[model samples]
Target chain A: MSLELRGLSRRFDNAQALRDIALQVDGGEFVALLGPSGSGKTTLLRILAGLDFPDQGEVRIDGQDMAQVPARHRRIGFVFQHYALFRHMTVFENVAFGLRVRPRASRPPEAEIAARVRRLLERMQIAELERRLPEQISGGQRQRVALARALAIEPRLLLLDEPFGALDAEVRKGLRHWLRALHVELGLTSLFVTHDQDEAMELADRVAVMQAGRIVQFDTPARILDQPANGFVAGFIGQAQRFAGRLTSQELIFEGLPLAPLPRALLLGEAAAGAGQGPAEAFVRTHEWQATPGPGNAVLRSARAAGGRVQAVFAVGPALIEAEIPPGLLEPGETCQLDPLTARVFLADTPFATG
Target chain B: MTPRPAIAEPRWARIVLCVLALVLLGLFLVLPLAAVFTEALRRGWGPVWQALSDPDAIAAIELTLLVAAIAVPVNTIGGVAGAWCIAKFDFPGRALLLALIELPFSVSPVISGLVWVLLFGAHGWFGPWLQAHDLQIVFALPGLVLATLFVTFPFVARTLIPLMQEQGRSAEEAAATLGASGWQTFFRVTLPEIRWALLSGVLLCNARAMGEFGAVSVVSGHVRGETNTMPLHIEILYNEYQFVGAFAVAALLALLALVTLAAKALLERGGPRGSLAA
Candidate 1:
């Protein structure tokens, strides 16, 4: 019941849309492909759905090769971002379309088809919209109809391409939760592509971060957030103020300050991190450092008014330096003193923080 | 609330411009129609009725209407298939095929008829083969129909191609993902979206087919009873010094064109609503 891609690649004339890549999803696993635009995430999903073929790769579902299988034969349900519900069809007809078009192998009797479609409509909570055309319904309702239409075929695998991208923020949030619950209830193997990090984080069992047609990190949401494989993943995962700095044996040296002194264990970890790591970088979660003024606190070297009367105050730390000030409290070109020791250190070349 | 003042403009100048435009329209577009009506009234209703009752004239008008009705749907089907091929499929010589489809529109109608004649005339290519098989074309009804078909083919296909291309491939692909078979996707999703454009294309094709004269005339050989179309009937009457009868026939065709136009509008309104309601 596992899906695997081996050496998948696709090229369009001068541009390589998908470089040689490989990935796997275990049975009933929900994996989200997260990437910026043109990173080839959607292309990979298309290949998996059999909508497009990779120039060089073998796609296997449950150990069965898909070389001879056309997209119609693959039995994979796909949900589109725009819903793509048949604008001319009522909700009931749309949900029934898949079943009605089924081949002899999986075709159900008319009564059974109707019952199945009704069940799916009930499941998606769109029975009331059964008679409504796609144009007559709201976007969210159309999306649900699209989902029901896809699910009615009883597909072995489900693929969703930015299913919530077109919706507003509030609808997106609710739909994400509903999709997660439905996935759990159905126990269906699913892969969805999304550019929104929050969507990937909140919905996927495993988030696969993509960049330049390659996966930078594939792990649980918390793991990827806490230990991003590279700077790109780190920056993509969460908000962290970073300062470029050099590493010392005992401390992170940045702006002439001994930032949070590294312990022996973390220093050893940093030393053994990678090759040519002299010009490494450090990052500090702004919420981690408390803002205070005292002689014991590090002196704020520079400050400027961020906006209106609010000020941004900068101070040096042991391993990293950051700015913090109350709104309209610190004026421009002012200095303040703050404490250090709450910063995390990482080798500049790589994105992994010193544990 | 206060009353607003009108914008400044010389009232006489506006009136004069409107009159000038009306005069231009009369000279260019209305005068000929007025002359046709006046000429028809010269012989009273007797010549008009006689022309309408003539077997040759009746056959010509019927054939024209029949050819238009048949050719329009054939072209509509061809248009949808051709549009889909150009929009969705990529194959070698696709551009050339598209160019060929549009060739009828740009090439001279006389040349188009001559080309068909060269292929099917008694002394032409395939002529002996068609004769041996007892198939009639070139100077026959079939030849007239074929010539009309050739010149009208591009009307529907051209109208539909750009619309289909602009829609992109997403909706159909999306339907495929939802487990719709090719036919279902076409009828339920693709056809519904393009129905309006399809109707418009059909109207254009029908209008062109009905009005076709140059290509049809060359191939029809003007066989008064068998091959003469409505336009040909009108021309024959005028050439025979039957001016009143010619104008009467012309008026009849004009009335048919008006009916077709009204039908087109009604179809456009009804077809789209039906598709949406489906």
Candidate 2:
């Protein structure tokens, strides 16, 4: 089933937890809600699961309005960071509980329930722990049981709130792959929330990058990493270092240092044309810079240095100037010539240092 | 050869500290109990059992345990529901409701008893209406139960509030998303998570109820064979100069308290054993 949320908002007494959030997931698609803590990614997931009701907006599942539906009636499966297994119940009983408690129309017979639970336990690779209470199992195994229980109901959608967050680094890596395979096997629409960039990139079909209660960019992982919507998205999604600069005609200047050629589209208006080059910023990949000697073509700036090695620095103008050099080629006081290969530029209205 | 070492504290300091500790312990806890037990045992063990086996005293013991059994569970449910409501829900007067629940803990047991008596006595507000319905409360079994319930109500609720507050709403919401109905979520997920804490609260409530003499005595009217509890029975023996019998009843109550304390320790040591998933 497809799921959609529009203009979802919630506010606590002290702070706004979520605001004007809108998103949709196609059937059988796996989406990751990626954001830092307090960014409202979990809040958004809870709203979709019907565990939380948004102060505004509506949730629709496969064309059915879910705003009025209770969480159980919505047929959504939510897996928590903490596995949340029923500690007092055996693994088998915990898995079977969801089905056993269903209304008569949806309830399976005792034999069928037992069979399903057994099959699921086997599928989850925890069959040996069927009779063992949750307290007897390890954290990772408990998470698997929680998943098996949630899947036992055959839900229309699945929501995972940092499912592997509680596990150690090694266990988290293993569960991510296992979850990907499970999603394929079940063919259900799923949304997993996490702040780990690598996990989101590896696990989701689409990565929705969120910051401060808003989705800054939502696209395939590769596209988001390669071409972010803005400097925030770029810095957030991947390892592109930023710098401060100003735009000139076909060039960006940083701290009185002229950078390499800028994209024609970026060089617009008075600021781009250098009328009020004013303040600007730029971002460049570390690999995008080249080392050279002397003021060569495309060289942005050259500074004085000691020893035989000179320190040359190039600016992408909208960003900062960076240099590439051989190991021990230039000491702290040495200088080298540099040039930038590509520049993603941003405008800053006031003069300031780049960090 | 070098000297081996000097102790952390001088020998005289150590001896003085130990004696001080012993003296404090004796004055606060050991002395009174020893005095009571020695005086009672001197009268011979025969009279102690005779007083304990007295039909009225026996009845009082039975009634006290019965009341505790009923009240503990009722308050357990009440405590959990109350804790959940205060922790997880927001509405007007919530703070006030919380304050009111804690009133029992701060209010003198005698005052608590007086409040119940004022409400259930013949000249009290609900007395005539209750009498009209042929329901007895004042100086009756229900009055004794009411007084005991009032004094012990805070035990479970107060114990549970902090625990419930510490355990957040994420787990319950997670259970709900897993297709568990509200009741199933509570029984399977929420209840199990809080089981040990709830049990401790219940035990504490039971212990307090057993020792709840002031409130119960005021409303029970100390009827010889009807409303008197174990504590009241002990009081009756002491008043009749049957010190040995009083100590016997007190010893039995102490044993119950010890059992409750031991169970509490075991449950606590278990330490949320099966509660974690990852």
Candidate 3:
């Protein structure tokens, strides 16, 4: 189902959880609500699932107002971060709960429920664990059971709140494919909430990057990586180091380092008409710079080969800048000049540059 | 993670503490319980059977069972409902309400019994109206049940609150989001989770209801056959110097307590011990 939120606002005594939040999800799209903790992404997901109500604003599912709908009737499946599976129930029983709870007239027969639960467990790759309780299974298996349980009701929209947050990394990577495949096979519109940017970037079709109860950017991961919406997004998205600089509409220059001036066009998304360059900051990732042999003030502190690339750190004056450059560029402690020509410096024009 | 050496302590001190604990328990608990059983059987089974089969003893037993039957379930319902309200929701005066639920625990049993008297006694607050209306509460079965209820009021709710709070309502919310109605969520997901704690609480509440004395004494008015519970019956027999009768009834009460404790222990075995410890 297509989902839309308009001007949603939720306030607690001391904090505004969500403020005038507006979001739209096209049918069958996998959208990630990416933000730091306390950013209201989870609150927004709860409101969408009818587990929580907004103080002000409308939640519409397929253009129908959900104001009068209760959570049980919404048919919007929600997977908790901790995988709130019934600890006492076996995997089979947990998955069948949604179907068995239906009204007598609508409830499936016992044989049908069993078959359906088995099929869902198999699809979750946990069919053999049907007889085991949740506590007996691994974290990843528990999450699969939780997902299978949520899906048993045939919900059109699935909401996962850090579904893999409780699992370790190796298991998390394996399960992401299962969720994406299920989303595609079921053609369900899924909204996933996570603070892990890599998880969001790897899984989401489009990510809604939020800060302080507002969506700062809503775009594909590639666009968000290349063109951050604001200073916050620029700092939040990539693991980029910050260097205070001045942009003069022609080129960018750093304060302490005597590096070559960067042309204006290299600072991607910073060329808004008349974007003044006084007291600005630039975000540069490790791979954005190149090292060419030269006798310069910058010293090549160390270089290491990693993942088929040369990962090295340079001591440029008092600051340490990491760069992923061409292999055999420079030996350790060698003087080399930085070539930020192919580098895409994410520039934040604002003075409050957190990056 | 490997085993470590125990903290070194003087062997004499450890032996002293262990002996002290055993001696204290033998003097205070094991000795008295054994005395009750031994004294009851000292006159042999013949007199003990006669004392147990006495009309007054039989009536007291019936009354005690009836009171527990009425009070246990009433308190169970109230306790579970109160616990659900306190643990599952936040509202104004929640702390105050919680404190009030535990009020009986803090207040003396006599005071709690006196409270009912003040509310329903013929010479108490509503006593005159109740007497004029020919409605008997104090010095009757209702009064006895009310006193027992007052003393055991906190058992189930106190047992449930900490556990419910810790387990949380996430599982219930998950069930609701999966299309289970509120009642369905409770019965299928929530009830099964808390069943062990509930059973443990019931055992304790039942044990207290059967053995309550101070509160029941304040309101029972010592009506020999009608109002006296098991403990009160034993008290009256002891006062009349009927050692055999009193000891027989005391042995029965002790057995009941032991049975309840065993049940509670079994329940603890089946679930987290900390849940029942609350």
Ranking of all predicted structures according to TM-score, beginning with the best and ending with the worst: 3, 1, 2
Indicate the worst ten consecutive residues by lDDT in candidate 2 chain A: A346-355
TM-score, every prediction? 0.84, 0.82, 0.94
**Candidate 1: residue pairs that collide:** A258-A318, A259-A318, A259-A319, A260-A319, A280-A348, A281-A348, A298-A338, A300-A336, A309-A328, A310-A328
- In candidate 3 chain B, what residue range of length 10 has the lowest lDDT sum? B269-278
Candidate 1, position A321, lDDT: 49
* lDDT tens digits, residue span A1-355, model 2: 8887788788878888887777888999999999889889998888887877888888888877787677877878888888766656799988897787787887889999999999999999999999998778998999999899889988888888898888999998898899999899979789999999999999999998887777777889988876665566666665556766656655676454454555545532224433544456666665566666444333344444435533445443243454544444444433345555665665664322111
Task: Estimate, for each residue in A1-355, the C-alpha lDDT of model 1 and write its tens digit.
Answer: 6898878889977788887677888999999999999989998888888888888878989888884466777889989878767666788988888777767787888899888888898999888888888888888888898888888878889999999989989998899899999998998999999999988998999998988888777899998876666666765666567666676545555545634444323432323353334555555554445555444445555555555422344545453344545664444334444544344445665642211
Candidate 3 on A1-355: residue-level lDDT in tens?
A: 7888888899988999998888888998999999999999999998888888889988888899894477999998899999889988999999999999899999999999999999999888889998998878988888989899999999979999998898888988988987888889989889999999999999999999988888878899999998776767877888777777777868878778877877776666554335665666677888788777888767888888998898889998888988897888789888987766533343453432221
True contacts kept of each: 0.66, 0.76, 0.94
Interface RMSD for each of the candidates: 1.5, 2.0, 0.7
Q: What value does the lDDT take at residue B205 in candidate 1?
A: 85
Mark the regions of model 1 whose C-alpha exceeds 4 Å error after superposition.
A104-106, A241-276, A279-284, A288-333, A337-355, B1-38, B90-99, B118-136, B271-278
iRMS of candidate 3, one decimal?
0.7
Candidate scoring better on TM-score of 1 and 3: 3
Q: Which stretches of candidate 2 lie over 4 Å from their true place?
A: A131-137, A255-280, A293-333, A346-355, B1-27, B34-38, B53-59, B90-96, B122-136, B255-278
Clashes of each: 10, 14, 2
Count clashing pairs, candidate 2: 14
